[model samples]
Target chain A: MVEIEIDEDACVGCGSCVDDCPNDVYQMNEEKWKTEVVKVEDCMACLSCHEICPAQAMEHRDIHVAKRLYIDRKVNDVLDKII
Target chain B: MDMEIEEIRGTFRPELIPKETGGDIEDYEEALHVLMKFVGSMSSALEQVSGRGANAIVYQAGKRMGHDAAKMMEKTDNLEQAMKEMGEVLGVEFYFEMWKPSDQEGYTIEKGNETVVKLLFMDCVVRQTLRRTGLPQKGPLCYLLYGYMVGAVEEVMSIKGKLDIDHVGPNACLKTLTIKWGGK
Candidate 1:
């Protein structure tokens, strides 16, 4: 099962994830005015919400993290030395 | 900086096969990146020149490839079996699986003469190529996979099929495949 964690302190209640998720995995908490994971079972780990979220307040755990081969390793090595 | 190219000298004969490929992992990585950039440039240029027709052209090309790839596979009327076979045909690079909501009883839903199934593509080469060139999703390149899946299903089941993109993201994408029963 996929577990979702939302950082309420960072959440601006923008509801972008709620709007972006195709599976309705998230819903806005009217009382807290923040986002909450309602249906985590339907979450497909697409991570589109992370892109749309301005605050980056959510994290999905124990899901298939797709391979990202686009990142250049040589560029990362230079950045790693500088940082 | 200048780099030296290592040349391999080997005698080749029509009957004899080479025991090893000369390239290393770095060579493959560089080749893959170059191919991605080339494909991305072609896709973008095609879109710029042909507009929406570029998608159809790419889709047709992908569909033809899919048909050729699936030609040797066993034919079946079962959608699930065909999808499993398609996973093998697409191999690891285009890894995908059938998806459904928690509340849904099954992965597939039937309506009238059509059966719909949600496919969650976990790893797609098209998505990777788009990211490599900073191209947005749902562009002309994405249609290639759409046509590929539809073509494979149609060939396997002898039925008309279509794939619609429901959502796309950096990590994954969701698409709905609809298969219509009866003769093509």
Candidate 2:
């Protein structure tokens, strides 16, 4: 089963993930305005919500990490040194 | 900057068998990456040159490839069977599976003469190449898979089908495939 974690401190309460998720995996907590995962099983690990969330507060565990061959290794090496 | 190119010299003859391929796995990997960049550049240039029509051009090409690839598969009216067989034709690079929302009872929905199913593409080389080239989603290259699916489905089921992009994410993309069970 996919596990989802939301950082309330990092969450800006923008509701973008709530609106963008096709599976309704998230819902806004009316009390705190922070996002909460309502249906974890329904989450397909598409990661669209992560892109839409401005605060980058969501994390998914035990999900299939798709291949990202786009990242250039040399560029990453340069970035690693700078960061 | 300086570069070096190593040349391999080997005697070749038209024969029943060859001794070796004369290259290692790293050679293949380097070649593959170069090809990826070449293809990505062409896709972007095609889009810039033809505007929206580029999608149709690439789609037709993919549809033709799909038809050719699925030619050896057994034909069937069963949507699931056709999908299963077509999955092999798409292979692991374009990995995908049928998907549905939690509230949905079944993967396929039947209404009158049409059948609808959602497919979640998990590992798509086209998506990776697009991202590598810094192109946006749902561009002309995306239609390649759209036409490929419809072509395979049409060939297998002998029915008219259409695929519509529902959403695109970095990890996966959702598409709705609809098949009309009547004449071609």
Candidate 3:
């Protein structure tokens, strides 16, 4: 099962996730203007919402996390020291 | 910043088979990254030069690879069994599973003369390479996997097949594979 958490404080109510999700997993709470997980059953954990969210308000748990081989660890180490 | 390069020196004999693969983990990692960059650049360039034709070319190449890889395997018309065998051949790198909506009872669907199934690809090397290059989904590179699956299924079942991209997500991709009866 996929568990999704929406940070209400961080949510900007932009509705990008509501538009971007293919499975209609999210819906806008019109009254509050924040995003809510309406249909959690259909959420495939695609994480497109996470990528599009400017505020990084969403998190997905217990899902098949794809391998991210693109990140160069050595470069990251250097950045870690500088940042 | 200045980068340091370390060179390795070795003695080679023409007649003898090399026993060990020389290189540390860092070397392998560096080589893998370099290869990924090379492939990413090649795919992007091919797409730019050949446009949509690039997909056909890449698909054909992937199909050829699939056929060659599955040639030695036992042939069967059982789709489920063939998929299981193919999973072993593809290994963990291309991990995938049959998927259906929660409301649906079974994975396979039959309509008319076609048998359809949805495959959810969780970890695909092509997807990784695309992400490495910062390319969007549903590009020509995606066709490679589509053709590869079709080719493998065709080889195993001795039937014609097609794969359609349903949805592409960062964590997973859903593809519809339809096998047609009778010819090809």
lDDT of candidate 1 over B9-96, digit per residue (tens): 8876755545455678888788889999999999999999999999999999879877877888899998888998998988787899
Task: Please give the C-alpha DockQ score of model 2.
Answer: 0.70
A1-83: candidate 3 lDDT, tens digit per residue: 88999999999999999999878899999999999998888887778899899999998988989888777999899899999
Residue A36 C-alpha lDDT in model 2: 96
- Estimate every model's Cα lDDT from 0 to 1: 0.91, 0.87, 0.86
For candidate 3, write residues B75-142 as lDDT tens digits.
99877788788888876777888888777888888889888888888888888888877888899889
For model 1, the stretches where C-alpha displacement exceeds 4 angstroms are B1-18
TM-score of chain A of 2: 0.97
The sequence of per-residue lDDT tens digits that candidate 1 reaches over residues A3-65 is: 999999999999999999988999999999999998898999999999999998998899999
Docking class of 3: medium
| Candidate with more favorable, higher lDDT: 1 or 2 | 1
Q: Cα deviation of B152 in candidate 2 (Å)?
A: 0.9
Model 3, residue B33: C-alpha shift (Å): 1.3
Give the DockQ (2 decimals) of all models: 0.86, 0.70, 0.76
Model 3 chain B: lowest-lDDT 10 consecutive positions: B12-21
- Please provide TM-scores, in order, for all candidate models, with all chains considered together: 0.93, 0.90, 0.93
Better of 1 and 3 by DockQ: 1
lDDT of 2 by residue, B1-184 (tens): 4658899987777672555767886676666678778888898899889998999998998788778778889999988788788888787778888888878998899989999999889999889988887788899889999888878887888888989999899999999999998859
Of the two candidates 2 and 3, the one with more favorable lDDT, higher being better, is 2
lDDT of 2 by residue, A1-83 (tens): 89999999999999999999988899999999999999998898889999889999989999888898766776787799999
